[model samples]
Structures are given as structure tokens and as C-alpha cells.
Target: MNPTLRPRRLRQSAPMRRLVAETRIHPAQLVLPMFVAEGIDEPKPISSMPGQVQHTLDSAAREVERAIAAGVGGVMLFGVPEHKDAVGSGADAPDGILNRAAAFLAERFGDQTVVQTDLCLDEFTDHGHCGVLTAAGEVDNDLTLERYAAMAVAQAEAGSQLLGLSGMMDGQVAHVRAALDAAGHETTAILAYSAKYASALYGPFREAVDSSLTGDRKTYQQDPANRREGLREAILDLAEGADIVMVKPASLYLDVLADVAAVADVPVWAYQVSGEYAMVEAAAANGWIDRDRLIAESLTSIVRAGADAVLTYWAIEQAEWIGARA
Candidate 1:
């Protein structure tokens, strides 16, 4: 049998397969998102997120060190305080858990890896809203911006190089950026969650943060049905001085991630949210799928979709796997 084009010939060699692979995952493209509880002496396992924990300050530092050793790009830190308030005073206090975590990470691993912290009040707010409420029981968009600005300054002062504005309030990026620059933190960067949709995927995260949100976030967060609006938000954030723009729930929003990445002049990132991670892990635990293969494939798919970086629960393990292959 004679064939005009022998496609199998190229496929026959391992080196050919490598050369033709269009998408590859790297350790440096992955970021680990961690949670730290203020008063805990030991790490507490989050039942919803298997094998993940709410770390103590000491344990959080150890986790960051491990992530660095694993060659992960960075760590997104969330703090769980023992108290809550209407104004989320914990978010602005230099001695607060989030600030302490930022300071500790900066002091220890500032030169080794990028230190990022959640700059939102939901975890500290009694009502579980992103900001202080008004006389009316609504999550005030303008009011939230003020809180976000202060949170940004606090996080920056505590040594956070990147402020993750996850509050979903209007003009959040611009507000945080102005506050940072006004405080003489010209080097502080904003990673705006530009396309965050109000999704149930955040259930585990809410639990991890001990949030008691009284109502849904539909008031401020974008509805999942609006694809064009997602792009608009990303563009607006870029114009508002975001160094990096991100789409949340990466697996479910790959199209959004791709679109943003295509038009983005700066780096584009995605957050593979809690629900997506739990789904994969649950399937693997039940012997329904190959865990490592699926994890690598999912991360590779995000990369192929044009995400410059991915924030994932599997980041540490994924980084180690990619590094080992290298």
C-alpha cells in the first residue's frame, strides 16, 4: 500500500509528538490559593475541599514555601478571622490575619514568589457582603469601592505585591489603583476579577472563609448569561489600570477566558473555582477517572484557551508533576 501523505510517520517518533504538541503546561504558570485561620494552632481540613486546609500562620508560611519549592508561580492568600464587623475592620488593621499573612509571606518569600492577598470584606463582614451596608439593606456599590480602596492600601502596606479585587463592585479596579498610588505604593499591582459571575461554585470557598452571607451576590456580580458584558468588564478593568485581568471559574468560562486573553494587552489569568476542583477530585476518588491525567489535562486546556496563568486548587501538585516531567 502506497500513501501520498504518511501522517503516521510523523506520529511514530516521541520527539515528533513533542514537537507537534500545541499546548504544554508549566510549573510557573500555576498558582495556589490558600486559606489561613487567625487563631488556629494546626491546619484544619475543609470538608468541601478535600486534602485542602485552613492554615495557621506558621502552616501558611510552610505551604508557601512548599509551593515555591514545587515551582508554582504564586499563592493567593485568604484570611479567616475569629471576628466580624459591619465595616470589616479586620481588613484594614495591620494586625489582622490577612495583613499578618501578607507581611509574613513578604518577609520570608518576597524574592522567591509573588505574594497575593484577597482584598475583599466578605470574609470579615458580619452580613457577608463585600462592604459596609447603608441605611437601606442593599450592598452599596459606591460604598464598597471605598472599603476596597482601604483594603488595597492595607494589603499593600503588609507586603502584598498583588491585590485581588474579588468584591465584584463597580469601578473596584480604579478605586484600588488610585488608593495604591495615592499611598505611594506605585509598584503595587491589581489583579481584577474582571469576569466574576455569581455562581454556586464558590460554596466551598465561603465555607473555608467562614462566611455567613445573608443573600446572593447577584446585586453586584455579573449574570452568567452575558458573554459580551464579560468582555466589557475586562476591558474596563484594563482601562482602570489593572496589571492583570482574570476570569473566574476557568473550566466553565474558558470561552470568556479565551476572549479576554485575545484582546488583553497585559497578562490574562483564570481561577479554576472550588466546585470545579471538587468535581474532579470526587470523580477520581470514586474511581471514575484518572486523577493525575485529568488534572493535567484540565490545566492544559486552560493554558490552551490562552490563560497566561491559572489559579487552581491543584496548583501545587500540578506544578510538581510538570516539573518532574521537565
Candidate 2:
């Protein structure tokens, strides 16, 4: 009654499973997304996200050092400015909080890891929209492009090696690419948030960035129900000269991630977003699931779905686990 060939042989032992695993995760393939807020002199804990914090400039540097020591690939920076305005003037200012942090990181750790900045206006704008609005309160697309172009130059000037174009504005990639080149920032790269969906999993993130959203972002962000549209957006970003493309809230959109990865010539990354991380922490806090194992499993699933790299809150811990396993 015994089978002649047993597939379970590979899954029989931990070592066997490790050795024969088709997908693997490494420290170098993980990127940690961090927040640094103005008006906070200390690392402020975020309640929705149990283990995350809004770090001070110095604390942020210390955290990045830990990430480097753990061999995490990169750090993505988001800024929570002290002031908000109709036009998000702080977003591209030379002395803006985001720009200052970008310059600090680039100056301190340029040779150690990639320095990336979120090129979005939501955290700076009073309306909490990704772009400027007209007198009628509708987002102005072409005018938004102008703001993005200026932000691109500003970020480049601050030494951001990778600009995360996450605003979801039309023609954003082309506009930013032309702006960067015209300003002689030819080497700074773009990581387009190509398949970002207007998902319900961004609640914790809104808190993370101190978002002052007036209305839903459905006007710009893609609908979660559209699968083909995800790939279409990625293709458009690629055509517009994205050095890398990413899908946000990665786990819920494996199909979209795979679709983009299938056609993308550059590296494909995914964001294991704040809400996704918070859900796991909440479950683990209630003793409902094994914490460490699920973190590894969640990340592995995203990579298996075709992500070349992942931006996760667990990047440091996961990298440590990866090293311990090695």
C-alpha cells in the first residue's frame, strides 16, 4: 500500500525542506520602511503598529545602523512634517524634514545601503491628498506633475539614491524622469508604485504618516477589484522609465504582483504594508498564532509570488533570523 515515490520525503525534515526550498529570502533582499516626524524629539511609539515608532533624526540614524549591521538592503524614509499646507510646500524645500533626513542618511551611509525617499505630498498637504487640488477641490493632474518634478529635483539634491514615486499621478514617471535629467540628477533612480491599490489595509499607515485625508484616494489609487489594471499600470510605468516597479500591500495582491513581475525588466519590489504587519501583531498578541514563523512565512509568500525585494517592518528581525538560519 506504500507509494513508490514519496514527495513527503523533502518535507519530512526541517533541514530537508530548507535545502530543497524553491524560494528563499535573504537579508539583502529586504528593505525596511521607516518614518521620521518633525516636532518629535524622541522615538514615538505607534499604537496601531505595536513595535513601530516615529523616530527622531538621531534615533533614525541609530536604527539605520542596526539595519546595516543586520545586512538589510535599504531603508525607505517617510516624513511627517510639522506644518501642512494647500500646496505641500515642505515636500520639496531644501530644508524640509524629509530632505534633511535624506541628506543625513546619504551622507552617513551612502556606501553602506541604498537611501530611498517617499516622493509623495500626502504627509505635507493639509488636505492629505497626493497632489494639489483645484478651486473645485478636484485633484489637478498636470499641476500635480509640476509639483512632482520639483520634488524630484529636491530629493535628488538631497542625495536620495532612489525616489519612490508613490503619488499615483498620471504620467508621473515620465515627468519625474525628465525633471531629474534636466536638473542633472541623471543617476538618481525611480521606484514607481505601479500597482498600488486603494485597499482598506492602509489605516495604520494613515496614522504612521499622520495623514489628514479629507476624502478617499479612489480618484488616484487604482481600485482593488481590477486585476488586469494592475499590470497595465506597471507596463505604463516601465514605459515611462521606472528603474524599479512595486505593488503595495503585497500579500493581498499576489496576482497583481505576479502580473507585474512577469513583464517588468527591472527589479520588482512589494510593500508588506503597515496594516498587514499590524494584523499579524494583533493576532500574535492574542496568542492566536506563532509570531516569528508567520513573519517568515508572510515574507516568503510575497517573494514566492515574484517579488525581488520586499519593504517590510520586520526587515531587521527577519534579517537576523535569516542570518541565524545560515
Task: Flag clash pairs in model 2.
Answer: none
Best candidate, lDDT-wise?
2
> lDDT tens digits, residues 81-170, model 2?
999999999999999999999999899998999999999999999999999999999999999999999999999999899999999999
Q: Which predicted model would earn the best TM-score?
A: 2
* Number of backbone-clashing residue pairs for each candidate, in the order shown: 0, 0
Model 1 poorest ten-residue lDDT run:
317-326
In candidate 1, list every pair of residues with a backbone clash: none
The RMSD (Cα, Å) of candidate 2 is 0.7
In the range 1-326, model 1's lDDT, one tens digit per residue, is 98898788778888998789899878899989999898889999999899999999899888898999999999999999999999899998999999999999899999999999998999999999887788887888897888888888999999999989988888898888888999999999899999999888988888899997988888888898888988999999999989999999888888998899989999999999898888888999999999888988888899999999999999899888777877
